[model samples]
Target: MRIGETAAAAGMTTKTLRFYEDRGLLPATDRAPNGYRDYPHETVSRLEFIRRGRTAGLTLAQIGEILAVRDIGHAPCIHVKDLLAKQLHDLDARIAELTALRATVAEFHEAAAAGDPAACDPERICSYL
Candidate 1:
């Protein structure tokens, strides 16, 4: 199949397919005489795998490592688990920070609703209610 057809089948853009190829995630199997990329039917599965990996918060380099393991006929479950663990830790930290920020914003909103003109402190740049 051509790049366009393969990309559509994988629910990705042709540009994304080309980017994956450049990133060494999905190298083309062959090229036509006109220089168009020729991909095998399985390319869709590969692209889907890449898409899922990215959605799971894996970077291209991380996905490339998984692909390398697959290419070498090894299971990538361990590596993927480790990566997910790290991402979860990072996400937890971000969630805590966002929760604190939300509390601060809610407090400010309450003060503004109370008609406290001092709420709009010029030093704070947003102190006025």
Candidate 2:
């Protein structure tokens, strides 16, 4: 398949395919004698896997590591599981931090809502703050 056809089949733009190639996320493809890229049909499947990995919040480097493991004829399932576990742990921590931040902001909002504009200190911007 050609680059455009492969990108369309993979539901991505041609530029994204080129970017993936440049980033080493994709294997090097053969070129036609006229210099256009000639991607294999299996490239579409690989692109889909890359898309799924990105949607799961995996970094390109992490995705690359998984691909590297597979390229070396090994099953990357264990590595993928470990990576997902770490991602989940990190996501939980971020959610906790965001929850605390939301509560603090809500309190500040309540204070602001109850504040009198006339009572705001001139030295500072607002008394509520």
Candidate 3:
């Protein structure tokens, strides 16, 4: 199929298809006489895999590694597990930070609700901010 048809079949934009090609995540099987890209029937499945990997918070480079493993006829389960572990750790850190921020915001809200104009501390910056 042509690039446009492949992209449409994959539920992605043509630009995304081109970008994946450039990143080596997807490669054209051949080129037409008019310079259009020709893709295999399995390209749709590959694109779906890439989309799923991205949805799982994998970066393009990480997805590329998974694709490389697949290309070499290896199952990517172990590598994917490792990547998910790291993503979980990063998410935990972010959750901690957000929890702290929520606590601080709640404290400030309580202080303001207590009718303390000092909570608006104009000498520095807006306390509500």
Candidate 4:
């Protein structure tokens, strides 16, 4: 398949495919006499794996590491597991931080609702903000 066909199969734009290639996340493709990219049938599956990794919040470098390991005939199972655990831990921490922020905002909302707007300070930004 050509770049267009491969991109369509991967559910992404041609530019995205090019970006992945430029980023070295994708391997170089074969070229036709007309100077067009040619992809194998397995490229679509590889694209799907890339898409899944991105959706799972893995960085390009991390995905590249995983792919590099696989390219070397290694399963990368343990490495992937450790990376996932770290990602999950970071996500949990961010969620907790956001939850606390939400609680603070709720308190501010309540206080603002009960306070007198006429008493607002003229030399400073809104305290609620």
Candidate 5:
């Protein structure tokens, strides 16, 4: 299929397909007579996999490494397992930080709600914050 057709089939923009090609994530199987990129049917599934990886918060480089291992006829099971473990740990840490931030913000909101504008201290930054 041509680039536009393939992108439509994959539910992505043509520019995204071109960007993936430039990033070495998508490889074109052939070219049309007019020299436009022609993608194989497999490219659509590959694009979906890439989209899922991005949604899972994996970087393009990380996805590329996993793909490289798979392309080399390896199962990539160990690499994928290890990568997921690290990603999970990082996510847990970020979630903790976000939870703490939420608590802080709630406290600030309460303080701000109770604060009197007439009592604002000029010597310090906004006490509500």
Candidate 6:
């Protein structure tokens, strides 16, 4: 298959396919005598896997790690599990931080709402901050 056919089969744009190839996510393609890329039909499956990995919130580098393991003829399930756990842990920490920030913002908003504009000190900017 050529690049266009592969991209269509994989439901991605040609540019996206090129980007994946440039990022080392896709395997190198063979060049025809005319210098056009010739991809194997199996490249479609790999493209699908890349899309699925991105949908799961995995970074390209992380997906690359899994691909590397599989390329080496090993099952990457354990490594994928660990990566998922770390992602979940990081998400939880970010949620906690965002929750705290939301609370702080809400308090500031309430203070600003209750504050009298006339009572604001001239030397300072927004007193609510």
Which digits, one per residue and each the tens of the lDDT, describe model 2 over residues 31-117?
999999999899999999999988867789878877776677755577666865776687688679889999999999999889887
Error of 6 at 91 (Å): 11
lDDT string for model 1 (33-126, tens) is 9999999998889888988878866689877866776676745587766865766676688679889999999999997798967656566654
Q: Clash number for model 3?
A: 0
Over 14-61, each residue of candidate 3 has an lDDT whose tens digit, in order, gives 999998989999964699899888898999999999998788667898
Candidate 4, poorest ten consecutive residues by summed lDDT = 67-76
Quote each prediction's TM-score.
Answer: 0.58, 0.60, 0.58, 0.60, 0.59, 0.59
Number of the top lDDT candidate: 2
Q: How high is the lDDT of residue 11 in model 4?
A: 96
TM-score of predicted model 3?
Answer: 0.58
**Model 2, backbone clash pairs (residues 3+ apart or across chains), number:** 0
Model 2 residue runs over 4 Å out of place are 75-129
Scored against the true structure, residue 101 in model 2 reaches a CA lDDT of 95
Taking the tens digit of each residue's C-alpha lDDT, what string does model 4 give over 1-129? 999999999999899999999998889989999999999999899899999988867788878866776676755587766865776687688679889999999999998799887787788896677
Per-residue lDDT of model 6, residues 1-129, tens digit only? 889999999999999998988999998789999988999888999999999878866789978876776676755577666865776686688679889999999999998899787886788976567
Q: Give candidate 5 misplaced runs (Cα > 4 Å).
A: 75-129
Candidate 4 residue 61 Cα shift, in angstroms, is 1.2
lDDT of each: 0.81, 0.86, 0.83, 0.85, 0.81, 0.84
Over the stretch 1-129, how does candidate 5's per-residue lDDT look in tens digits?
Answer: 888898998899999998988898876468878898888888988989898888867789878866665566755587667876776687789779889999999999998889787786788896567
Total clashing residue pairs per candidate?
5, 0, 0, 0, 0, 0
- Write the number of the candidate with greater TM-score, choosing between 4 and 6: 4
User: Which residue pairs of candidate 1 clash?
Assistant: 119-127, 119-128, 120-127, 120-128, 121-127
